[model samples]
Target: MDSSIITIFLPIALAIVMAGLGLELTPNDFKRVSKHPKAVLLALFCQLVILTSIAFVICKVLTLPPLLAVGLMLLAASPGGPTANLFSYLYKGDIALNITLTAVNSIIAAFTLPLIVNFAIQHFMNDGQHVGLQFSKVIQVFLIIIIPVCLGMLVRYFRPELADKLNKPVRIFAVVFLIIIIIGAVAKERSNIMQYIGDVGAATVLFCICSLVIGYFVPRLFGISSTQARACAFEIGIHNSTLAMTIALTVMASTTIAMPAAVYSIFMYIFAAIFGTLLNRYAPSVQPSIEQAPN
Candidate 1:
């Protein structure tokens, strides 16, 4: 929570995390999007439109505090976390589709996140003077997202062995960084932490459930295979809470605004596991021979 950590360490940690995500991505992932146009487009529509609308409705219906409302909206606008790929792999989803969704959605989020945040600020904050991410800050968001990812991709493209070597460590550091950010956000707003949970807790859980459901069922309803639907489920379910928290804590400079993401981070993985279990047991389209289905 120190200014030094907020201003310096957090951004660097975020960049490393984003770069680590890039290490998983490559030009082929983007190209793969072309092979699955329906899955790709529907997934984007769910992320940018449907889920965001659901988040807005939850904020309004729950009457979340203004900062907290913005925070939830911010999380909704965020792309799938990098971990979606891992979840997809574990759940026997289409890994290629997962990678494509993650890659494309992240790039789209750089622009859409700021727009969504700005709308949330104007609607929810009322008298709050925190100017939402303006053009300069939008540029900052783009750089924060794009540059490290591109650097990581370049590393992967050139020195794949080195990229592979650094990947796990960078991911470990990211998890540590997320824990610290959540703790720092909670610590900074300790008195309000309990109140925050009481207020936003249900909404976060509801949003998480809706995200997974919409990500999966909608795709299936449209005739997409269950494997692709599971990929969509995790991709849409496990948000980039790190990115949301970072933008809230560092870019927006509000611990209150960071609270929803911190709280959501606690529930996402647990729920994803449960959801995956049900899918694998009941309606799974993934072949059972895959080694990770049980893992």
Candidate 2:
């Protein structure tokens, strides 16, 4: 809410959260993509292309306001968070695939997010109202998203024991930070919060359901294994709302633009759990296989 918090603490918090992600990763995670090239590529297509296009269509169909439309696009562009792995593990999805996808998606998003956000800004916001992701801001986004993760990976490489020790605390702080950001964003728009939810609630809900369905079914259509399809579902469905919200508030400096993500955060977990449960219940059975560590 405060300028100081937006300018300083938000980025610092995001960096710590991303570094926590890095603690769980290594070069091997990225390399593992080669083992399941089809699954990985299909998942990427769903995340970067199909889901983003779906979000655009929804924004157009729903006629969301300019800022909120951009917010939805930003959320669509965000990579899946660590929670997707937990869901994958819980629901018998390929946890290894989840980890690999998260690792790769985080890396890819640094480039794609700026392009999508800039396009959304130019397309949605008119000349006087535009908030472009200029060079400096794009660098800020890159530093916030990429550098901290690299530093954390370096920490893991040099002092794994310490990295292990810091892992849980950083995760706890990440959740806390997400809660604070969502609360702050909502509070800033308290008077209009109800209206905001009324405006975007259905769009977000539909988008979430479409994401999960598309993420799973599209891969399955291509003959991917059920477990890997499940992994794709959560990977595409559970977005990094924290990242979207932070960029909206800090980089874009618009709480209105943060509303979609904040509201989506409220509904994402609930919908993801329900979708996972239904999938486990109705989807054809698969033999239980030993979970392999990512190579």
lDDT of 2 by residue, 86-183 (tens): 89988889887888899999999999999999989888886779677999999989888899889999998899999999999998998899999999
Give all TM-scores, in the order shown.
Answer: 0.96, 0.96
lDDT of 2 at 209: 92
Clashes per candidate, residues 3 or more apart or on different chains: 0, 0
lDDT of 1 by residue, 214-272 (tens): 99999888877788889999999999999999988888888888999999999999999
Which residue pairs show backbone clashes in model 2?
Answer: none
Question: Model 1 scores what on Cα lDDT?
Answer: 0.90
Instruction: Evaluate residue 236 in candidate 1 and report its C-alpha lDDT on the 0 to 100 scale.
Output: 98
Rate residue 99 of model 1 by lDDT. Answer: 83
Cα miss at 45, model 1 (Å)?
0.5
